[model samples]
Target chain A: MSAKEYRFRLFVAGNEPNSRLAEQNLRALCQEYLPDRYDIEVVDVLTDFEAALDSNVMIAPTVVMEAPRSVTLFGTLANKAAVISALAL
Target chain B: MVENQLPNIRKCHTRIEGLDQILQGGLPTGRTTLMIGGPGSGKSLFGLEFLYRSALAGEPGIFISFEERADSLKNNAATLGWQLAPMEQAGKLFLLEGRIDPRAVITGDFGIQSFFAILDHKLKAMGAKRVVIDALDVLMRLINDSRREQDELVALHQWLAERDVTALLTVKAPREGQLERNYDFLDYLADCVIQLDNRMLGQLSTRRLRVVKYRGSGFGSNEYPFVIGSPGITLLPISEVGLSHQALGDRVSTGLTALDDLIGGGFRRASSVLITGGTGTGKTTLCSVMAQMACARNEKVLYISFEESEAALVSAMRSSGTDLSSTLALGQLRLLSAMPEAMGAEQHLVRTLVLIKQMQPSFVIIESASACKRMGTEQAAFEYLMRLINTCKEMGITVVTTNQTAGLHNLDEISGIGISSLIDTVIQLRLLEENAFLRRKLLVMKSRGSSHSHSVHDFAITDQGVVILQKAD
Candidate 1:
C-alpha cells in the first residue's frame, strides 16, 4: 500500500518580520492541519542567499509547496487561512 | 579693518519658517536631489515646497509632473497653500505635463535627444533656476531598455547641472526591498538624497525625513518629524520650543457671544481652528459668521467652499442675516467655490494660494475639509490642506477650517487621518436627540496658547444666523 504524502519548503530572507511570521504560520498549520502527513523545510535565505537566488526567488517569505514540481507563492504570510487553502493541505 | 573675504556662504532659504533648519539651509543649492519614498511620504509636496520657496525668492522654477495632470497639479499645490498659477502666468513658475510611451521609445520612434531639447527650451524660455521632475520612476518605466533609462537619467542630470539649475527628482521606493537596494542607482547619481518615511507608531503614523547623503555640505542626519500644516510643510526640528503662540494679537468674533466667551475673547489671529460636528450642527453657519465678522472689520477675506457654490454660499449667508452681498460688492469678501472632484488635490492647493495672493486676505475659511477626501487621492488632499493652513498662518491670517465627522457617536472616526493633531483650536459640535428633537452642542476640546472656557454651549441656526444659548451652570 502506498500513502500520498506532501512535502513543502518555505524560503525566507533572514529573520525579517515578514519571513519570521511566514515560518511560524506555516509550521503552526502543518502541526494542526497536516500532522503526520507532510514534511516541512524552512530555509533562511540569509545563510543560503545564493540558493534562494538560484531558485529565482525575487521576494522573501516565499512558500514553495512541492508535490512533484515546486509551486511557489510570494508575499507576507499574514493570511494563514488563505495560505493553508492555497497549498491544498 | 578692511573685510575683503565674503562672510560664510549662506544656504538658499526656503523662506518658510522652520523648514530651512531641517534642510540645514534649504536643499543644496545648484545640485540635483532625489526624494524617494512610498505613497504618503510627502515626496510630491517636498518638490512643490522647494519650487514654491524658490519662486518666492524671485527665482523662476518649472514643475514637470508625470503622474498628475497639469490642472490636477495646480489644484493640489493650491490646496497645500502654494499659489503656482499666478507664478506660471507671471513667468516665475512653469508646469509641463505630457504622455510618453515606452513602446514607442523602444521602437526608435521617440528620441531622448528631442526630450532634452524640449526641456532645455522651456528652461531657457522661462529662465527657471529651479526644476522639479515629479516621480522619475514613471519616466523610467517609459524606457524599455535599462541602458537607455540609465543614459537618459544621467544625461538629464548632467544637462541640469550644466545649466546651474538646482533640480528635485522624486521617485517611489520599491515595495519589497531595503532602502539601499530599492534606490541604488538613484543614490549613486544624485548629489543629495532625501528619504521620507511614514511609519506606524502605536496608533499614529508619523512622517520623518532623513538626509541620506549631501555631497559636500553639512546637513541634519537625524530623522526630523514634520507636520503638514497651514502655510506649507513645517519640520519640527526643535520640539522643545513652542512658537504657535508667537502671533499677532488679533481676534475674530464668533457671532455668538457665548461661543466667543468659551474661546477666551475670540479666535486668535494666525491660528488654525477646526470646527467639527455631526450633520446639521451649524458648522457651516458658524464659519460664515466668522467670515462676515472679518469682512465687517474692512479686512479682506477669502472663503473656499468645497461643498457649496458661490451663489449658494452667498444665499445661505444672506438667509442667516449676515449680509455678504455688500462685502462681495465692496470686494472685501471673495468666494472661491470648488467641487472636490473638479481638480486634483495639488491643483486645488495651487488655486487656493493663488486666490490668497490675489486677494491678500487677512482671513481664510475652508468650508468642509472632509469633502477634499473625495478628490483623486486622499493623501494628496490631506497634504495640500496642511500646507495651505501653514501658508495662511505664515501670512498672519486667521484660518477657520470646517470638518464633518463621520459616525454620529464615534469620536475615533473624527480623529481619522490625524486632522486633530494639525489643529490649534478644536470646536467639537455634537447632535443630541432629546424627546424626538435634535439639539446641537459645541465643545471646545483644546486651544493652544490661550485659556479657553471648557463649556459645552448650545447653538441654533435661525434666519438671524447662529445664536449661542447660555449654558446652564
Candidate 2:
C-alpha cells in the first residue's frame, strides 16, 4: 500500500528573514524525505491574521503536521533533526 | 432604523416576557453578556435561543460554536420548534463551527485572533446584530496560560463592542477548583453575568437562572426557576416587582345557594378559596358544582386535576348531578390532568403558569392539595402552591383549591401544610358518624375581609348537586 498522506501548515509573519528561511527549510525537508506524500500550505499571519488564528497560530515560522497525529514545532525549521522528529517524517 | 432610533438607554429585548420585565427591558445593547453554568445547565440552549429569537425579530445573528457541530445544533433547535435551517439558508443567521480537532492540530501556540477574523467576516456578511460564542471554555482551554485567557476575553469583548453587536458568551464551570476558574475574570469583562445552575433533590432535578450582575442597570438578582421544553426556555418569576393588581367587588355564585349564604354570598372575584376535607367528604363535588356555576355564567374554568384523569373526573361528576360534558364541549371548561411525580416542582409550576396564560380562565380549581406532595418536600410544595395562588390572584382570577385531611373528625388541622394561612377563605368539610349512619358536615372556617357563618350545617350530595340542609340564619 502507498504511504499515508501527510498534511502540513506552516505559519509565518510576512516575508521576514526567519520566515523565508523557515519556508526554504520546510520545502527542502519535504522534497527530500516525503516527496509525493506530503503537502505544505503557507499562511502569512501579517496578511491573513484571521487564518492564523483558525489553526491557533501564535508564534511565527511555526510548522504544523496534520497526519497520523498532530505535532507542533515553534521557530524556524532550520533544525532539521528536530523538525523530522516532531513531524514524524 | 428602529434599532438606531432606540432610546439612548439602549436595550436588547430577551423576548422572554417575565425575564425582560425582570431585566427592566432587556440586556444592555451591543455588549457582551457572560453566561456561566455547569454541565446540563442549558447554557448553550440559552445562548441559541437568544440568537434565534433575535433573528426572528429581524436582527440577524451568528452562533460561533467551539464545541458542538453546526448540524447537531440545528437538530437540537428543531426539536424546540425553531427551524434554524431556513434562517441559515435565507442568510438571516449564520453558524460558525470553530472546533479544531485536537488530533489534527499540530500547533500548540495559537490565539483567538483567527477565530475573531472569521467572526468579523461572518458578522459583516450576515449583518448580524447578535452573536453567541458557545462553550467559550473550550476556546479558553486552547491557551494554557490564565493571562492569555483573560486577554483573549478582553479582546473579544472589545471586538464585539466595536461592531455594535449584542453578544452572549457561554462557559462551563470547572468541576473542581471553581474559585480558581476564570469566571471572575469573565465576570469583570462582561456587561452582564448570568449563572445557570442545575441541581438535584433526591429524584427531582431543577434548573434555575440567576443574574449575577448587570452593569449600570437595576435587575432582579433572585434565582429564577426555568425549564427547557416544547416552546423553549421559560423562567418562572414567582412575584412581580409590586402588587397593584386591581380587585373587583363583584361576587360570583358557589352553585349552592345555602352554601353561598354560609360564606356570605359566594366568593369575591380574584379571591383564593380553599376547601379542606377528609376523604369522601365531597370536596371535589363542591369544586365541580362551583366550576359548573362559573361555566354557566359564560366564564371559563380551568380544572387542574392531579388525582384523577379527565374522563374519570367528568364521569364521576356526571354521576353526582353535574354535567361537565356540555361545558367541556363549549370550550368554557378545560381540564389538565398531570401526574405531578413525573416532573420537578418547577417544571410543573412553569407548565401550569403557561397553561393559565394561554387559557385565561376566570376560575382555576386545583382539585387536590395532595398533588403538591409530588414536589418532594412539604416546604417546596407549599412554596409552589403559594406562587400558583399569587399568580392567579394577580390576574384577577378566582382560585379554588382542595386539601384532603387525614381522619373523619380531625378538623383541627386544615391541610397540615401551613398553606391555609395564605388562603383567603377556608371551607371545612368533615364526615361525622351519627345515629349509626355517616353524615357530612360543612362549615366556613374562615373568610378574610368578610364575615362567615359560624354554625355547622348538614351537607349532602343529592340528585341536584351539593345542598346545605340548614337554612340561612
DockQ per candidate, 2 decimals: 0.01, 0.22
Using TM-score, give the best candidate's number. 2
Candidate 1 residue-wise lDDT at A52: 51
> Candidate 1: where is the Cα deviation over 4 Å?
A1-89, B1-213, B218-245, B248-251, B376-378, B408-412, B447-456
Q: List per-prediction Cα lDDT, in the order shown.
A: 0.71, 0.79
Q: Compute fnat per model.
A: 0.00, 0.10
In terms of lDDT, the best-performing candidate is 2
lDDT of 2 by residue, B83-142 (tens): 887787888788777775554333234444446556667787788878988998886776
User: Candidate 2: which stretches are off by over 4 Å?
Assistant: A1-32, A43-88, B1-9, B105-108, B178-181, B408-412, B471-473
Clash pairs for candidate 2: A53-B114, A56-B110
Least accurate 10 contiguous residues by lDDT in model 2 chain B: B104-113
Q: Number of the top candidate by DockQ?
A: 2
Measured against the true structure, the TM-scores of the candidates, in listed sequence, are: 0.49, 0.88
Model 1 agreement with the true structure over B310-346: per-residue lDDT tens digits = 8888887788777788888888988898888776565
